[model samples]
Target: MNYPLIVFRGLNLLVVLLCASLALGAGKPLTDFSLEELMAMEVTTQAKTPQRLSQTPAAVFVITADDIRRSGAVTIPDVLRMVPGMHVAHIDGNKWAVSARGFNGRFANKLLVLIDGRSVYTPTFSGVYWDIQDTLMEDIERIEVIRGPGGSLWGANAVNGIVNIITKSARDTQGGLATARAGNLERGSGALRYGGKTGDNFYWRGFVKYFDRTRHHGLPGETAEGDWDSLRGGFRSDWYPAAGEQFTLQGEAHQTRAGALRTEPLFTAPFARLNDEPTETDGGFLLARRSWETDDSTRYRLQAYVDHFQRRRNLLDEDERRTTLDLDFQHEFAPNALLDITWGLGYRVSRDAIDSGQVITYRPSKKTDHLLSAFAQAELPLVAERLTLYAGAKAEHFESVGLEVQPSLRLLWTPSTRHSLWLSASRAVRTPSRTEEDALIVLSVRPFDPPLPLTSAGNTNIATEKVTAFELGYRGLLNDRVSLDLATFFNFYDDLRNFEGVPAAFVLPPPLPPLDALFTTRNSETKARSHGLEAALSWQAHERLRLMGAYSYILLHVEPRLGEEDFDFSEEKTPRHQASLRAWLDLPHNLELNTWLRYVDALERGPVPSYLELDTKLAWAVRDNLSFALVGRNLLDSRHQEFPVESFLKNSVTEVRRQIFAEAIWKF
Candidate 1:
């Protein structure tokens, strides 16, 4: 393929379109807000409270609804690529490896994810199943991404970052919407949604969505087997029960059948071979929340949710069912004119039942775990509105890890309304997952005559992984038409996860071969330190054109404590440099054009070579509530690899291919 020529031609076409649009000046601009208005936007994920972006003492980025629609991203993971410090890579057609800063993998455990205040991080594997996390993209209000530790408020597993997906209120989406899309890679997809009002105070909405994705190219001539389809339906309702009180109820259910190619070792003659398998998953959740404000300027909220899921995987011969129940309460008050305080309490219980497989087994097939936590933060104004100080901590108790405490201190200095500077230091931890403490896995087997097997045994005495991070940031409006955000961080890690070699043992059966080597999962003497810089710039080039650019550089170093071996692969997993540029232009005849160009550095371990790609979208609005769009993704190349196959799962490596799709949306 003539990759360079294709990219050149694409860019030329984009330029030609821009020229025509400028000459005609016909379409409405996507964003009419000024840089100051953008800087003054309020975000909640940073502190669990509303704070202006320019004054918040954290590294935060928000993706608005307009950004989502213009990015031509079909999935949440693809939309996240715009964040400066975030690393998003596709493992296959149905799987992705996403992380922040460093330590990227199939199951990146350090980053925490939430959907409408409900956590989606699974306790079974300490990671998310990206294939099943879905919703109607049009209904998403915004995605708030915190690029630093949120442990002081959100609790464990939030060591690196937090991603919160917030949806729009039912009242904002009153009407009926229908959408359909088709393409070579996407296959087919459609959505139907309706919103109505029962009374003056009550609003409700319901929606159903379905999608089928085709498989991607495999390594060279091999056929990659990952293809998936999903169906989901959900509803949300909001009621203003009284003058000072409000209530919200929402629920969703989903079913998915995903295909994959797995390689596993057998106890018999042929050590390992390929296995074509399909994974079946079904899940649902219901959540309710209530909020009230008192005349004395005090606020209170209560929320609860129940979630359940079941999965069947043939490659591991495992069938699993899990359920979780969580409850939380929060209060906010200003004791005095100079000081404000926020506090919360939470409880969660999770239970899982697993049927063991030939390759993997859990000591206790059925187990239950509980977590209790409380957190409080106080904000003190030092120099009126110019300087402020914030301190907070969270204490959590669990059966396995006893008690864990995370604390943070932050200071923000606003020199002017247009610029602010901030610094923070925090501590966070990651608790052990069920698989790390109870499962025994057959990592691989040597093709010897006797068939020597290498196994990984779980250790019950594993400790929590911990990190202490320091960060400094600046957010400012460079001018009336431009804005800039910069952040730098240094992190130190301790008690990191590692595998230690154990003595080999023989099997009881006489004909069976002995275990060649064994390793146990544990918190070894491995330590690490990382530093990075991230910057983002936004320019409203004209009333009809907007441009955004981002760049990030990171360096991670790992070493053994004293004379111990590292025995970890954290250093080579993350890329060293990443950059992206995006442009949105309004054209004549109600036309819109958006383009994104991105580059990712290679991973040292897989030697996955660096690659650059482009995605473009062109849309035409026929009326106020009807539109059509043509989207092209990965136009620079036919296919390219983004990540290597996971070592533990041994899934087949696949490449991302060029895709073109057309979409039509109608609202009545």
Candidate 2:
């Protein structure tokens, strides 16, 4: 009855239904020649410059590749569900739990993902494995969600958000390209690309992609074996020898096969079941970057990367391999009209191997880890263009928290150019992985008559899972055809992560005698508090239409720490009110229509109920480089279950049917 008071009465009835739908369109009649071309958009993960998203002071969001081709999404967690305080669940059929603002599960350890600056999380279970994170969503080129706590310029797990992704260079993809798709649960897909130029200063591109999916429905709804498939390829090169120097290189490779159910631990007595495994994965990566600039306020960058991964499952008799090596450096300077600077340095090394049998193990079994980081950010202009100040700090050294420090402070206020205001304070951390410091698990076997074996151990003195955040933002354009964005937050978490159950009872006197029970992993002087509200609105509903909406509300409170009262499902499994609505039309000769509507509120621990979804896309343009489309997704549910029933794969609950697709794109 008290779900954070129904998320504050659904955010006060969504601010009175967004002021009665903007006072019923405030007497429409304003079209200063528009095709909804508002332009002025740029972001760079919060402060690596490229500002303007109404002068970002954080709580960012930018997902464009034409908003992922008009959002009838395909993958990337359904294009991050059009983001607004994200939490995109869908546990099986290629697992995803995606989080932001509140720790949603499936390895969600405070979200931090990147792909142009490479880092796919997963320090062996520190999140992000969204089925191998593919690319070619039309060469990305956007996607910069950064909700809260960026750990003073990205260090540590960036605490609660950060997903960069950025692609599309190589002179913005130049030559031939192709794409094809077919669906009923995406039963086929394809992609191919090529780009070239070598005359004056390099530029090259290459790509290949594939996909297959189908099979989901369980819990009496039949068919569920988690079907999946994958194949990939990639290449890139870009160089420019003059005017601000630049050089780059890229690489990719992939292979996958999936089918899972895997959950075994039985010794008769209705112990455990669900087995049907066949999983394989392979991975690759290579990256290099070099940059220099003398204008645009000075700049510098140098980067390096190499990664490799592998996984195989035979019903929890897993086999895994991982390798990583990374190096990075950054510098930016203004040194003039009121200072603006940035600095960075990082180094990483990871090596892993496991082939353990019988349910899990990692005690040493080959390991190597190292991480070092440094960061700095600064910008101060007391009133040069209407008050601004931002400061940052970061320091990291890992091998189980040997050093850590993260800091931030931000402020921006621009009373004019159509409003803006911002405020922030931050600190973030979440470190400790390798399955929480060296895995080894069992967790159950009790049934009397010689069989008691509950276990769980792996904790090299765990510590570090902290947050401290506060933010407030506002952005308004109110006159150029409406625009508004508001953000609010308050978070404070500490030492979170709990488990400690010890009830010793062991004996092995003469020949043999046995009994066992033990559990450990704690550091929860538990404390959690979360508060939120996010709002977005954009309207240009005239020249060829455009409308956008977003809403989010979240509330979490926890105290525990004294005999931890069952940790109330860690924020009740996400979704404390949510919304998104979108529309875009521009038809007439070169047709295009897009739609998206969503609402979610109800997942109090997957008592999974509330839902409302509708996605659509229809396109046409058979000339300037071909195009055709049709996409429909969950058109009001024919199956649901976004997540729940996954605690070690308890049948990996599934169901997310209803999809339709047909697409084609070509360019030459």
Candidate 3:
């Protein structure tokens, strides 16, 4: 890739577009809110309580609905690129590797994700299945992202960060909406939605969506085999039975079919072969929540959810089914003028059944796991509006892990309304996943003279990975038109997962040769530390033009315990530097143009070179209820590889290609 040439062209194009957009006549401002309103936005993910962005004592970022509309992003992962210090990469058309700070891969386990207060993080893999986590983009109200530990409030697995996707309520979406989209890459996609009110206090909404994406191009003349398609439908109902009280019930179901070219290892003559097979996934979840506020300003909430999913993969000959039930309750109240308290209790149970395959098997084919947790946090007004302190801790218990405690302390100094500084220290943990405890996987088979088969066996005694993090942050309205947020953090990790070599036992079967090499998972004395800095700036350059920029830098170090060897490539998995700039312009006659340019540093381990990319969107509002758009993505390069093939799956390497799409949205 010609980095200089690509960057120069990208800048030139940006300038040309900006000049053209400015030359046109200006209409009404496209933004409904001013920059001040944006700066004062409220976020709930950081502390699980609504607070102004400037007052949140954490590294937080919110992706507003308007931001998403102008981003030209068709997927949730793509929209996350705007967040500083976040890494989003595509392994194929249907798979994404998303992480915060570092340690990024197919199954990056350090981050926690939630959808409308429901936990979407899978205990089976300790990561999110990005492929099937989807919804109507237009229905999302906002995405609140906390770029640090949330374990003190959210419990276990909130090691590095948390992402909470909040959708608009049925009352807010009352009406009818339809959208259709098509492109060379997207192929075809559409959505239909309707909302109504049964009475003054009750509202309901339902929606259905479907999309199909064509396969990506491979290394030269080849075509990657990861075409994807999905159909999903869901409904939401909200009832305000009385003042200061509300009830919400929602559910969704989805069916997905995706293809992958995987390398399958065998014990026979042909040790390995490329297998192109389709994977089928079906899943659904039902969630209910009730919240009420008392006359004295006390608030209480109770929520429950049930989730079930099944996956079948022909390449691996694997079939798995899992179901989870969770219930939670929380209360918030201020006992005095100087103190406020929030606490919660939660319980979850998960059951899973797995069918063995040729390359993978589990010691226990069926199992159940239980989790019990309680957390509390106190907010103290040490110096009234100038200085405040927050302290919290959570205690969680699992049958295998016994008891675990996570704690956090934070201090916020506002000094003034426009500028605020904060500091935090927190401890978080990533519990062992089912795969690390019971599964046996055949890693590779080298058809040597004796057919050496390398296998990895799970250990039941593996310990949870732990991290202690310290963070300092500042948020300031540099001026009326510009706002800036800066954050830095240092993290120390202990008892990280590692692979230890085991003495191989020779096995000679009639149809296969002798097997020799073996390894086992362990929470070895492996330790690591990381430090990073992130900065974001937003400038309302003009009434019709808005610009945003972000940059991030990270460095990680890892070492093995004394007399022990470590093979984990924790430090080289993520890029050390990343930056992005975006511009949104509203032009004459209800026309809008938006562009995003970004650069990502190379990954030492993926051996993937650095790359620069650009995405642009142009839309025209034909009427108050209808609009059309043309979007171009990856315009800077024809195609580029964002990540390497995953080790476990050995999925085919697919490059992201330039794509152009057209969309139409109508509201009634």
Candidate 3 yields a Cα-based lDDT of 0.87
Against the hidden true structure, what lDDT does model 1 obtain?
0.87
- Selected candidate, larger TM-score, 1 vs 2: 1
Candidate 2 local lDDT, 1-68, one digit each (tens)? 34455446544644554454455444432222232233357788888657777777877878778878
Ranking by lDDT: 3, 1, 2
**Tens digits of per-residue lDDT for model 3, 1-668:** 78888778867866775676567646568886777797689998877777899899999999999999999898999999999999998888888889998878878898899999999898877999888899999999999988989999999898989999999999999899999999999899999999999968999999999999987777555558779999999999999999989999999999999887888888777888877778899999999999999966599999999999998983365788999999999999998878989999999999999887767777788999999999999999899899999999999999878999999999999999999999999999989888888877777877887677777777889889999999999998989999999999999999888777454554533223446655555554688899999999988777788888999999988866643434333576789999999988898888998989999999876578888988999999999999999999999788898987666777777888899999999999
Badly placed stretches (over 4 Å) of model 3 are: 5-27, 220-223, 448-450, 506-517, 562-569
Please report the candidate that would top TM-score against the real structure. Answer: 3
Question: What is the overall TM-score of model 1 with all chains considered together?
Answer: 0.95
User: Residue 603 deviation, candidate 3, in Å?
Assistant: 1.0
How does candidate 2 score on lDDT? Answer: 0.77
Tens digits of per-residue lDDT, candidate 1, 31-85, equal 6466677788889998887888888999999898888999999999999999999
What's the TM-score of each model vs. the native?
Answer: 0.95, 0.33, 0.96
Q: Where's the lowest-lDDT run of ten residues in candidate 1?
A: 506-515
